[model samples]
Target: MTVEYWRAKIWGLLHDPVLKALHNNSGRGKNSFYKQLEVMKPWVETGKTPDQSGGKVLENILLADYIASASDRSAIGSVTASINYAPGKNREKGLEITHLLSGARQEWKINSHDELIKGKRKDYLVQKEQKELLAKVPKELQDPSIKDDIKKIKQLYWWLWRCLPQATCDLFKDNSLMLMPAETRIPDASIWSHVSMTSALAGALAGYDLTAAQIQRWQGNDELSHPYLAVFSFSPVQELIKSSRKMRDFWAGSWLLHYLSAKVCWQLANQY
Candidate 1:
């Protein structure tokens, strides 16, 4: 497949909720899904691999998958009921998800996260948005001469991390639930947090300067001998709510804490 094809395929995979739901049953698979996309950054941006052999590209992809799987063991026991259902089985009855804006339960389909955020309420109907975003993959792969459009790819990446969250928050009735979950397995973490951490992890891996051969040798090993790093941040909210006199005060304190936390995240994002 051409680089454009991989770009489109990665983009389509991330935006397709059905595909994510299908592949992300286990935490390792979910992390690997995103990690592989991150590892493809060089190909996605330059339309070329590290060398002429084309072997390094495959090595990088495998390395990313391996690292992601080995790094997280917390989700091994968190399998859900949806894992057993076949693809489109839930779609036949119409899948229901908590509406990000209203928190009201609704039957819907998310083909593209960007489109869903921009579309009206009626646009969410499963039959109305039946087109699969992955339909363009074959066409992209067939056209090897297609020019690399880095700007558009970057925009899609930006929309995934930035615009989608803003739009969701703007439409949400409750500030307490403004952020979207990164994955169903980890409901407390926001999608922004996951993406930011993935970016950071990818950056650290790049700086480590490990060769393809070394990564291949290390694959499937159960040791945490790799340079992977996880950073955690904590914000104490008890003090913020300690002075609350009423229920409204408690809500206000919580909103303030969320707002401040978001500000810190945005600052960190800007620094990079």
Candidate 2:
């Protein structure tokens, strides 16, 4: 499929069944639901125009699934229920299950050690493990990408780290027995990081080996101590890494081949 195909598919997935279900279920925060719809309405009414809302529309669209999943009973009840249920069959899966958007951006790079610490939610990380983990991130990841979009990708990684604690807490909270909130909405930090990281991870999975290399080092402990590593140890990552050669092949043949390969090639081809 072309990038346009995946883009439209993702949009339709969010705007149709997801949003439609939200409209009927006030239990899932009618305000948040409508807010998402409002952000998406321009595109829904028009077509695949530019992200004129400066990512706000995409943000709202993605959050809609999380909002829907927060409901115990609602218009989009069964659909959300199924989508939300997949993660944590084993805790080792970490927070990767929370990735809501498919075909997300996937440029993963850890730059400044200090910035990386901040992104990991310094307040939540074990001081010593944090230092070691940061130290171990391969020096290679810091090499500037030959591509033009490294700035944007770096910003995404930064935001993902920024959003880690809150989003991690929200997605994995033990709310199984608690009553569903009248409106289930995460803070803006979670929303921003969620979309940003999804893209970053997507980039990493598509052969940005540095991301996987970093993930391996971060997941060094069985405790899943590192915040981002713990939450991001989901199935897609495992599948993405398994049979690395084959995965790379599939990646090249897939639509991301068109989307990500061109970008990667641009960077590598220009590296001199």
Predicted model with the maximum lDDT = 1
Report, for every candidate in turn, its global Cα lDDT versus the true structure. Answer: 0.39, 0.29
Clashes of 2: 10
The positional error of residue 264 in candidate 2, measured at the CA in angstroms, is 24
Which pairs, if any, clash in model 2? 95-231, 104-199, 105-199, 105-200, 106-199, 106-200, 106-202, 106-203, 146-267, 147-267
- Model 2 weakest lDDT span, ten residues long: 15-24
Give the alpha carbon lDDT tens digit for every residue of 1-272 in model 1. 23333343243224223223222233213222222344345443443432212434233433432343334223544465443112334323323344444556643333343443344423342222123222222343323333345454454445444554444333332233234444444334444444444443433333333443433344454233234443654556666688899999999988887887789878865774
lDDT of 2 by residue, 45-143 (tens): 543222222232233334434443343223443445321111225312211211233424221121222332233322223232233323332333333
Task: List candidate 1 segments past 4 Å from native.
Answer: 1-82, 86-131, 135-149, 160-236
Number of the top TM-score candidate: 1
Q: Cα RMSD (Å) per model?
A: 10.3, 19.8
> How high is each candidate's TM-score?
0.41, 0.19
Which stretches of candidate 2 lie above 4 Å from their native place? 1-148, 163-272
